[model samples]
Target: MMAGTPSRNELHEQNRLSWNEATKAHNSHKGDQAKFFREGGSTLFPEEIELLGDITGLSLVHLQCNAGQDTLSLARLGAIVTGVDISDEAIAFAQKLSQESGISANFDRADIFDWFEETATAGKQFDIAFSSYGAVCWISDLNLWAKGISNILKTGGRFVVVDFHPVAMIFDTDWSHKFSYYSRNRKCTQ
Candidate 1:
């Protein structure tokens, strides 16, 4: 809480609005998710599949599941999957994709910070908390994100995060080592 900074609610609302717009743009630009699934395509990479290693009958929670492509893929692999995203458009598209793909999954539109409490109130817990590229950067507070994951997971649960190094993205900017690269504990603005 800063003297004049936007509140968490305000930040969430801002993110929601931006992601809602991004969903429309993504759905339009990216090849149809439903079409890809209907044609036997999976949004999951081989490494994630190997890491997940047989999710049959397991409960999975996908945080920042943009359009639920990977979430539905997990469902197709027999995991009871629930996806949470900040964008209503993304959730709606995911629901439609589920219907079109004839796969079963649940989609929720909520900020990641509220995920644990919301799912807890619904009496839902999961065996895994999954996220992939581009999701971690959306998190302004890592502690809250960690707490959310912890609260949502059952015993022996796993948290799987697969993404490019943030430093690599920095390199993508100007190909220079001007900025100091550090480990995860310290926070750095991009």
Candidate 2:
């Protein structure tokens, strides 16, 4: 391997550790998750909710589903939901949330890439594959991500991604932007 190239196992482990660390803060005072659920507020943003219109009875897989608030929301919306996350802590928390909220769901602890293969092999394609808000940045290869989406989705399935613009990553610490936005067909690089 090249000096900076991580083996797949190493990459997965690194991300898993990072997400495990983040889970506490993400589910606690730093986030509105508790308030949202307690007050019956939606965890999903308006754009995502609009995109996921009328998911009643649809089978949906939520990729990179950290803590699974959105996944639980989808279940409450009447979709059969499966939430996949890399962090075991996140999956556990999601399962706990499902139980507390009385919303039915399946939570899987696996890397996004592996989840796709597992589902595909099990012949468990879904009507929708969804992710939102900073999830894609954790993926090392967008091509593999796209292929995974294809592998586990039915022919007419919808895939929705609601995330910050990739260009946001280009800004400096002082917020002095450097790149002029332009149209290009290119994979994002970190």
Candidate 3:
């Protein structure tokens, strides 16, 4: 580590701030999300839906669930859903959305790694653990992430991650290579 370099916890705190700001900006462009979900709209794609078929009565934990649209969708499908995110703003909005949309779900604000440890120590386990899209890229340690997931899941529980390939991170929106596939322990800022 370099002199005065941010630790992994510091980097994650930075990411939490960034995602909090991003949640506000991202929601600004999407008109009336609560109304949409209230009207039975879902953000889930067909592939993920197929992969998570028949989740009714299952307890599912959504890791890195930003604003919890998919988590609420899972709840609507009769799963007992809990969504966890590091961003407090996102979790607040998710709770509001749950109330407004009349969907029953739990939203917690905590870094996923820490939350996993706390939840696992508290003897909590889920039948399904899910994460999607940009989730893994934010993680600083895949081994910890995997172990955390394992600790929080039931013996036969399923862990599903639907995310973009690392190759996709190499290219910018213009299809030009703009970033390295590896993090190299440095914080990434947008």
In candidate 1, stretches whose alpha carbon ends up further than 4 angstroms from where it belongs are 171-190
Q: Which is the leading candidate under TM-score?
A: 3
lDDT of 2 by residue, 63-111 (tens): 8999988999888788999999999899998988877766789999998
- Residue-level lDDT tens digits of model 1 in 52-149: 99899999999889888999999989999999998999999999999998899999887777777877777778999999988887687788789878
Question: Lowest lDDT 10-mer window, candidate 3?
Answer: 181-190
At residue 69, candidate 3 shows an lDDT of 90
| Candidate 3 accuracy as lDDT | 0.89
Better of 1 and 3 by TM-score: 3
Best of the two (2, 3) by lDDT: 3
lDDT of each: 0.83, 0.82, 0.89
Candidate 1 Cα lDDT to native: 0.83
lDDT of 3 by residue, 65-110 (tens): 9998999998988899999999988999999999989999999999
Q: State the weakest 10-residue window (summed lDDT) of model 1.
A: 181-190
Q: Which consecutive 10 residues in model 2 have the weakest lDDT in total?
A: 181-190
Rank the models by lDDT, top first.
3, 1, 2
lDDT of 2: 0.82
Question: Each prediction's TM-score against the native?
Answer: 0.87, 0.86, 0.95
